[model samples]
Target: MRSRYLVLSVSAFLCFITLCNKSNAQVKLANLFTDDMVLQQQDNVPIWGWDKAGSYIAVSTTWDKKIYHTVTDASGRFMVKIATPVAGGPFKVTVSDGKPLTLNDVLIGEVWVCAGQSNMEIPMKGYKSQPILNSNEAILNSSNPNIRLFTVPRGSKTTLQQDVKQSHWLAASPESVAKFSATGYYFGRLLSKMLNVPIGLISCNYAGSSIQAWMDPETLKAFPEIKTPAPADSIKEVSRTPTTLYNAMLQPIIGFGIKGTIWYQGESNYDNPAQYDSLFVTFVKILRTKWGMGDFPFYYAQIAPYDYAQLPPYNKGGKYNSAFLRDVQRLDEDKIPNTGMAVLMDIGEQATIHPPRKQQAGERLAYLALGKTYNFKGFGYQSPAYDSFTAKGNSAVIKFKNAANGLTSFLKEINTFEIAGPDKHFYPAKAQITGGSVTVTSDMVKEPVAVRYAFKDFVVGDLFGTDGLPVSSFRTDDWDYNVQ
Candidate 1:
């Protein structure tokens, strides 16, 4: 009887160990494929995860009615490529590893990732209450079944995440669009109208997030000269440096092909505008390299004007009236290979940080993508950028590169010009267009050495080219400020 009991106990222990091994060996899909997920169309959609070594895996989609199979590598990683359906779906994906794991209610559509700072995260409902609100009527009628949205909840960490805690795709309707990102909703709507295809927007933006938070740690560490040091306490808490929000939000979706990226940030990095030129180029280079797509359309909105204070001494940090950020953006045109900037100096509000004019912002971004990426003819994509400036006595003559059909003023008068002598003391100046160049002079300064256009935190300038695109803010001086 004792021998029989011993044999039974050993057998039970062996069975339990076997079951545990099998459970650990099985392949599991990421949380992104759970239910009501949207996959990018017209591309090879990748579904990957971890499993036991040498295990066979199979994935089947109902919308396309296709099945794909693969085997786990030595490291237990397995990837299967499946062609996406033309239209959106409420379909299912079934995965088999001896046992079955099914993902229900998926969609195949135009998947776009909307990223930026506070302005991009500002919802439509917030804009509805503002003075310059313009999209209330459009929001009321925004019930499109072909459009879907998935918002990544805001989180901060110094580690890469295999999956987001909570995020699910919802069909875009009047109620949904109102709560989603206003700029993202408008951009998606325009794309849907143009292509006549279903659109999916993945909004993963955080207000007050720095550009560094969206960059990989390795990339950031590789260029320590460019990296801003974090708080000492935060550094010592963890042996491994904290991965940025971009790693958590963007890394998981890297292999997933996206049409393009629409960005509207730069406010947080305004304090150190000098290094922004190099930082912006580095960020774009790494993003393109990681995505495996060379020079895809990357469009961004220039920082709009807003009042820092109502008093004088605006040149202290140079923060109040610095064109440094815009200058860095302008430099990107020459440095970065394929990129576009939508100038918004004309549309910004003087009092509000969150601008209410998102319709024009999104529309302009779409216009650039349409012209540059989709090959839309007769559409103007470039804005007025600084070409060259020459000093002519007490006045400076400035030339622009994208002065399409010549330059014009939005108010039909010259405004928002400032000239400074060798002392760097700037005074409000008057400007007038002469042929393709604008000559600026100020009565207060006898010998004007430098000229600045739209250099205030908030300027009432209407300077634009004949094409109606606003001229970018610029400064001819390399003066350093306390803000640095």
Candidate 2:
């Protein structure tokens, strides 16, 4: 009886071992390759997965009917780049390496990475009572097969994840658009209308996330003050913890083909506004490097004005004004190439941090991509940016760029302008729009050493180009001030 029992136990053990081997040999694709997905059109888009070690993997697309082959490495990781055709598909893709896998409703078109904090993550249905403008109307008209959307679930980890959890792609419909990012959805809607191609927007964002949270440990080597999270450590604020989101959320989706990225964040990083300039540029550089994409268009929205001091656990620090944060983002455009900023000067709400004008924000970002990136003509898409200032006696004339048809105050008085002398004390100035420049003069300042426009924590800007895009808040002086 004992011999018979031992033989039975050995047989059970052998069966378990065989099951494990079978599971390990099955081919698996990355999380981004599921149904209703869009790949960048006419590019060698990467599709990666794990399979049996050293096995030959073949991937074929219905549109091209071309089979791309590559061999798996020793670790069982396989990656193959398949050439996609131009912007049209309701296609099928299949992969095999002894074990078969398939993805349906695949699309070949423009793809964009939409990321940032709460503003970008806020859905079309909006938050509670704080509603997005004409959201219901937009949602009712959102049944389009050409628009594809994917929302990456929020995750924070000490180690890199190969795939996203609880995530999949869905085509645009009333139900899906209502839950999708308001900014991302609007941006996609505009692209689909203009380019007349399928648009894919991958929404990966976390609420109240700081800039540091999206940065990897290696990318943040220049800053020693930030500590890396250990696996065993208890992290209470996962969104605020550096390198956590980068590991779990961003690292997995790297190397996916994309036309560009659109960002809307910085409210969380307002307290450390000065360091954000460095952090922003570094993050963009690292993302560009990791993706192997050469300087793709990086467009972002300047966080709109809000009373920062009114929020809970708020710092009364006078220098914590949000304008500094906006300026840092504005300056980063010149520091990095192929980048643009959407100014929200006229769309802010002084009381609520989450501005209700998200559609405007989204459409503005689309304008940048349309004009600068897609090279659409016969439309003024850029805001009038402060270029240079020349002093003539008591008045200072500020010239602007992107004002080919000239600047306009639209019959409204430019009350947001201020002039300062060497003392750094600012006084409200009278502004006159002359051609592409604005001449400012204050009776108090005999010699204007500096000029600022809409530079307050919560002020509306009236200056604009003939295209109606408002000028961004700016300051000529770097002198620090306490706005108490």
Candidate 3:
């Protein structure tokens, strides 16, 4: 009798093990494909998951009730590209491999990745002791089912991760918007209103992350000095560590369909400004290649004006000034294709690194998208960048490229202009509006070889385009800050 019972128990245990193995092979999708997710519209967007190797699966979209088929690869990963319709959906997408898994409330619309450091991570509710200008009002009025939000939680690892652990897409409501990225929310809000379509904004950011942190190993290989974190190393700053953020945070969501990415980073990389110029281009190129998307609209914010040297002891100056970093960001626009930058020269705060006015930053990015990406005409989106300067004598007349409406100081005295001779010593210069250009001259510095506008650790920009957008901090000379 005991032997018979033992045999029966063994048989049942083996059956249970078989059942568990079957369960392990169940179809599983990336966390980004959760309910309420949005895919890019009018494109072949990817829908992927894992199942038994060699298993065939069928994906059905409710928008058209069409079935797309694919076979899982040797690694148990299956991916199928489906053609999405124009921006409008609260449809269902179902995947089946014997058993069916369905995602509800799926949207097909403009999807944007909103990424960066603390400024981008700051929520609509505002951070403690620091507030986004008119955040409360924005949050209270931020209810719209047309907008969707998702945030990738903070993580860092040495190896590439497959998917996020705890994440879901939430429809924009007062409750959800309060925790969502302020810049992302504002940007999406404007897009939804202007385009009158569903808008999805993914907040993928870590506070105080360096540019190297977002770069992949292949992209950073050229820079030998930047090293990845090892298992044995004790990490003090997880976000600042190279490649770890890309491994854990960015890697998991690489192929997700995105219209483009809007970034507001570079504060942490301010100490090394020159390298950021080329690194930014390499990062953007590799990212587009990985996504298999054509050069998409890649708009980013020029780091806001702040007293970066005033973080602690306030002794930092010269080479550590963040103006160089902003300049590199400006130069990146020329290096990369389909790129734009929202200059924040007017909104910087001297007391805090987090600027209170994120709405302007977000809206500026939207204007770039509407004008450049969507080809919406009229109204200025590009800031008036310094174009060419002609030095006839002591006075140098600087021409701007996008100042079609001409430049203005709003009747305020412009005191930030500086003129420098070949010796590299810059002196305060009197700037006068010369029709569409600005002519500057300094009594102290004759025969100026270069000109700088609002070029300092922290300066409230007084110069602006007639469209109300401020000119980015600029310097014509490539000399290092300590060259003098």
Please provide, for model 3 over 404-441, each residue's C-alpha lDDT reduced to its tens digit, 9 standing for 90 to 100. 88999999999999998878888889999976799999
TM-scores of the candidates in the order shown: 0.83, 0.93, 0.93
- Candidate 2: Cα lDDT at 268: 90
Give each model's whole-structure lDDT. 0.72, 0.87, 0.86
| lDDT of candidate 2 over 1-484, digit per residue (tens) | 3211111233443443344354446788888889889999989888998877876666767885666666678888888877888999899988765455788999889999999999999999998978898899999999999999999999988777878776889999999999999999999999999999999999999999988889998877898887878777767788989888998898899899999999998999988778898999999998999999899989999999888888867765556788888888888888989989999999888888899889999999999999999999999888989999899999999999989999998998899999998888889999999999999999999989999998878877799999999899998878875732
Which residue pairs collide, candidate 3?
Answer: none
Winning candidate number (lDDT): 2
On lDDT, the stronger of 1 and 2 is 2
Pairs of colliding residues, candidate 2: none
Q: What TM-score would candidate 2 get against the native?
A: 0.93
- The whole-model C-alpha lDDT of candidate 1 against the native structure comes to 0.72
User: Ten consecutive residues with minimal summed lDDT in candidate 3?
Assistant: 1-10
